[model samples]
Target: MSFIYSISANTVSRRVILSKFFKQKRLYSSKRAIILGIETSCDDTGCAVVDTEGNILGEALHSQHLIHLNNGGIIPPIAQDLHRKNIENVVNAAVKLANLSFNDIDAIATTVKPELPSILFKKFESMYI
Candidate 1:
């Protein structure tokens, strides 16, 4: 006499995968956060708006390459001065492109550390206004 044991394999159901996908989508949909990123640590003044889902809504950047090249080098005072003048326009353009107003932004992020000269830091701080 011979006897054989039956074996079975279990497969993941489609509903399980779909349920997980919808759960993830719900988590992402529950809230919206937009970040305005400003980078003024160097000769390039840049601004970007991004959402929590890793989408860039808008961006604007202005480079001081030509100005500094004409001067043969970056003059600290001139770079800081130029940033002061261009930051407003850059931020405004980015906001408009993103189709958002200042009030709609959840937060503003800027490079404010690794302190530069006192005057330069002050100039960067002024952009917050």
Candidate 2:
């Protein structure tokens, strides 16, 4: 299994980025690779399952815009808490939408932004590592 971390807001951009990454790394086989992407860099918890052909198998997103708006602005701690609360659900929803389990995924990808709080990594490690 392989792990690739990434951060992007647009679906098209993510595909492009992943394509380049896979190609540059020469990580391909006769079978198209299936990727699970997780994003929690900013105000949303997003997950998606996609194939090497740029097909979007499934996707889920949880936004914190409203909560932050209510709070006047994004607070790091609140954002971290929300990501912790939503990451699993979002990933599961995407996998479910794809009608496949984690066993079917070839690789896992996630956003690793500098501004991200450390607590989010703890949540991810507990779930996936």
Candidate 3:
């Protein structure tokens, strides 16, 4: 199994990273790997479960886009608070949709710095690590 946790807001960089993941997967494991990905970099909190074969087992997203839009723009404190409130539910929903518990997951992937808020990082760490 492999766990990739990092921060990169660039789409091109993300694609490159994912490509490398697939190539390395072949060198590292014989069995398909199940990955649970969590994203709380901004106003939205999201989670997804997927396998190396490009199959999406489950996913959930909690968006605060409209709230931010109403406020004219994103407020970091508000976004952080919403993330705190919603992360657990989003993660559980994704796991439930996947028909698996945390033990069934092979690895966890998340954003750890730069783009992600400190509160979210701590929250996720406390929940999973």
Candidate 4:
């Protein structure tokens, strides 16, 4: 029942930077681990339960993409409010989709970066805590 939990956007951000910096052909490869992932770096409230095998057991996403696009990019407070509004439901759906629980998760990871507003952590707390 042991699995890893990551709040990391590392998959989406830093890895790309490092890959580009080092001129590495391959930045990373997924391993044999189960991960519960959350993303609120912007407008989308996304959650997923995935195994190291690239199998997504469950996933939920609250997309503000269209909204932002229509509104002409992100409005900070609106983004934060949307994330705060949907984070919990999104994560819960992902977990339920995976048919797993927190006790089954091994670790928790988060996406940390600069220039991004506070939506990430705020959504984090809004989700569970």
Better of 1 and 2 by TM-score: 2
Sort the predicted structures by TM-score, highest score first. 2, 3, 1, 4
Candidate 4 TM-score to native: 0.62
- Residues 1-129, candidate 1: write the lDDT tens digits: 011122222421111011223334556777666767776666777889998799999999989999999999987778778877888888888888999987666655555432322343355445443
Backbone atom clashes (below 3 Å) for every candidate: 0, 0, 0, 10
Identify the runs in model 4 with alpha carbons over 4 angstroms from their true place. Answer: 1-33, 114-129
Model 3 CA lDDT for position 99: 96
**Model 4, span 24-90: residue lDDT tens:** 2224533344566666666787877776567888899989999899889999777877777777788
TM-score, per-candidate, Cα-based: 0.67, 0.75, 0.75, 0.62
Give the C-alpha lDDT of model 4.
0.60
Better of 3 and 4 by TM-score: 3
**Ten residues in sequence with the least summed lDDT for candidate 3:** 11-20
Taking all chains together, the TM-score of candidate 1 against the true structure is 0.67
lDDT of each: 0.64, 0.73, 0.73, 0.60
Error of 1 at 55 (Å): 0.4
User: Model 1, residue 58: displacement in angstroms?
Assistant: 0.6
The Cα RMSD in angstroms, rounded to one decimal, for candidate 1 relative to the true structure is 18.7
